[model samples]
Target chain A: MFDIHLDFDLLEKCNRCGACYDICPSCLNIDGYDPRAVIKDILNGNAGRWLTSVHIYQCLECHHCLEICYQNYGFENAMTAMRLRAARQGIHPPQVRRGWDMFVKTSRLGEPSLAARKKLGLPEPRESGKEEFLKLLEVYRMRRHGPSPCLRER
Target chain B: MKEFAVFWGCTIQARFPFLEKSVRVVLKGMNLPFRDMDGFTCCPEKSLVNNIDHGLWLLTAARNISLVDKEAVDLVSPCTGCVSNLATAKGEILSNPRKEGEINSLLKEVGREFKGTSRLYHLVPFFHDEVGIQKIKQSIKRDFSGMRFAVHYGCHMMRPSHSLKNDDPLEPKKFDNLIRALGGESVEYSTKLMCCGQGLDRVDQHDRALQMARVKLRELKNTGVDAMALCCPSCFLQFDNNQHLMEKEGERFNVPVLYLTDLMGLAMGYTPQALGLDGHRVDTEPFLKKWKEISSRPSAAAAFSEGMKKEGSFI
Candidate 1:
């Protein structure tokens, strides 16, 4: 049941450490993409602003912030928690939503390109973990709360 | 060399089968004990699946790892995302016996168990650490001598440092070292270690994705490098596919992208056609032509220096 926890202790440390700001690709390249602002809001219990903001998704999950953080707990954790919260509420980007849909239904983003594989002389693709995963998810759902909104029809 | 299963993650199989060809060609050339195993999935793609359902994400990764765990074979993947996600899940479970117990209980009902016993590696580090550069250098039929390549270390290849502890997360050298082992210059640039920004595209920020791709491609284009070499399919998509779209829109960043094995396959005297280099969106002709022109010369150092002077010294 680990759904992107935001340990305030680490978030507080991340808030105090600006080392990542200088190194995070989004911070340096993408204008107005500030994780510090998001962290401040999260610490103050005002994360509602970012739950719907694309900036939370903009963190890129690159782990550069994690690499640079003195606490090794980058603002990425905050960003991830926020993104998951938004997604659990069905407020994520449509492409992400579509990708999520495909993933759950097929256990893969896309199937092996048969024509491409033949052309490239690649061997047959091995079996996927779809059946096992679906079963495991069913068991997981039965044990946990009702199916997360992620699997619910919008 | 121990036997290991090759996790040909979703993107490479579904989108870039050519990259699969490249990896196979190189692995066969090296005669490594690589096996193809069933019962693996997307690595469940961290951002998409993990963002939506963390439990499902972890469970899927655990299940995928367990396939090899049962066989007692190690896992290696060309896709950095696959390796990273699988390794991250292993880390989570190994650190939490309670969570492992919980996930295992559920997996048991599915006829699987979560055992984080097997080792996981991205192909790049596996080659660097296990295969050893000496063997790689010996395997080269024609090395990339005197050629300059900008190596794009797709972030997941070596970040969240604790989990993928293969290289320095910020200042990685394994990919560069591999390039150099093939006798090419791993050109250093400011954005060398930057994330490929492919994740933005998955999240629907297409323009932003292109913008991120542009930042690195433009730098490489201006720097006048021969080609961009990377390992991740997502990074390849960002650089090759996104770059093609950018150029199609009348932008002029023509930095050709090459995978690590594509470079190695070429070094092993495999034809670009044989290695599936023909399938790349951005034409690899420029890279192949330059590699031919430089390596063919009797004096490669002279060719390298002359080529640098001709580029007017951003070198």
Candidate 2:
């Protein structure tokens, strides 16, 4: 599940322009998936119901829409808000849901195997936390939104 | 026993260890020094797929790069995603002093700072640029003169060139040049500039990914190339994995997917299994067998680079 960031001005800019629908690689390629519908939903003041689309999780955030939009609407921002809204409502897909768990616990999406790194001719992993810097970001994220759901379980 | 750092992202280690094996064999043949840090984390390219906060992605990326030593000059990655992610952060943070200060401040808290401005190179370009194509061309004991290949450049290495910045974005064919140097024919096609749909991995959208890959493979296959050379493991997986998905959906393409290093190793006479040709989603065994005969007997028509050079120089 994901929510698009919809400020009043940006919302007003949608203008029901079909360019986003026409240009979206995801929408065009899949069945029953339309970003314009999400925009329409947002414009209609139904943010909560928009999270039900499995289509929301498919956006690559390439900013193709943002780059082409006539109203200068930030589609990627809206997409991000949709994703966060979905995360808040527990709508994440299983793979992403599992990955979110792993990321928060280890602060790693997934660890490449040690043997694999050796074979790839890559450097061994090293410690790199600016311990204080990480703490501050965590605190900031926490204060802004009390304990991220991704990190909460971990 | 080389002296470079190992910058493994998720794909090579988890999904395609054969790519790692090929890289080792090729680097060993080239005699380049390298190392892998013991505990590096994800480069945050996946999270970015979700279009997660850029600041978080940057910090996570910086934190990962900061783990590398101050002395290492280049971080070689088998996965283009990792290379692109690091290149994006490094370019962004280093190019903007204000961003650098903010990143450095976060880094300092973890007792780390990215003082090292080492450029990140996807392994293919590093070999083509630093190792010298002429040098590699001379080392071709097993020439692939009669074999043809499609060079899959993968997007992150080129696009949004503003952040990661392609040294030669407009003309990204160092892989073709290096491929030709190995006695292999680099097949050019109309869709060479399109992506392999690897950029969709983070969002878990299989159909979108499949469709994106379909367009590129469809065009590459039409060119009648023997195999496709990959610089990134993610692209490799997407292109390779989607071949099966397409087949399940009744679209069949029997092209062999290969890492640039795998081709290099094959040219150096490494065993097919040693190079992990069998592990590919699209079986490369047929191409590997064909390559053996092609390499042993150079064709007079192996004029890929010569033809390109005659028209205009390829970057």
Cα-based lDDT for every prediction: 0.88, 0.68
lDDT by residue (B1-315, candidate 2, tens digit) is 225677867667767777777887888787788766654667766443334455666767776677664655467887777877777667767777877887776567657677646667777777877788887876677778778888877766654455655445546777788888988788878767555655566556666777788887877767788888878877777888878778777788878888888888877778887776666777777897786665565355556767777788774
How do all models score by TM-score?
A: 0.94, 0.77
Off by over 4 Å in 2: A1-28, A31-51, A61-91, A112-154, B1-3, B48-53, B94-99, B167-171, B198-204, B245-251, B298-315
Cα RMSD (angstroms) for every candidate in the order listed: 5.1, 7.1
C-alpha root-mean-square deviation, candidate 1: 5.1
Off by over 4 Å in 1: A146-154, B300-315
lDDT of 1 by residue, B1-315 (tens): 889999999999999999999999999889999999878878989889999889888888988888999999999999999999999888988888888998888788978877888899999999999999999999988888878899999899987778888998888899999999999999989889888888988888888998998899888988989999999999999999999998898998878899999999999999999999999999899889988987777685677888888899945
- lDDT score for candidate 1 against the true structure: 0.88
- Provide the TM-score, chain A, model 1: 0.89
What's the distance in Å from true for residue B213, model 2? 3.3
Candidate of highest DockQ: 1
lDDT of 1 at A73: 82
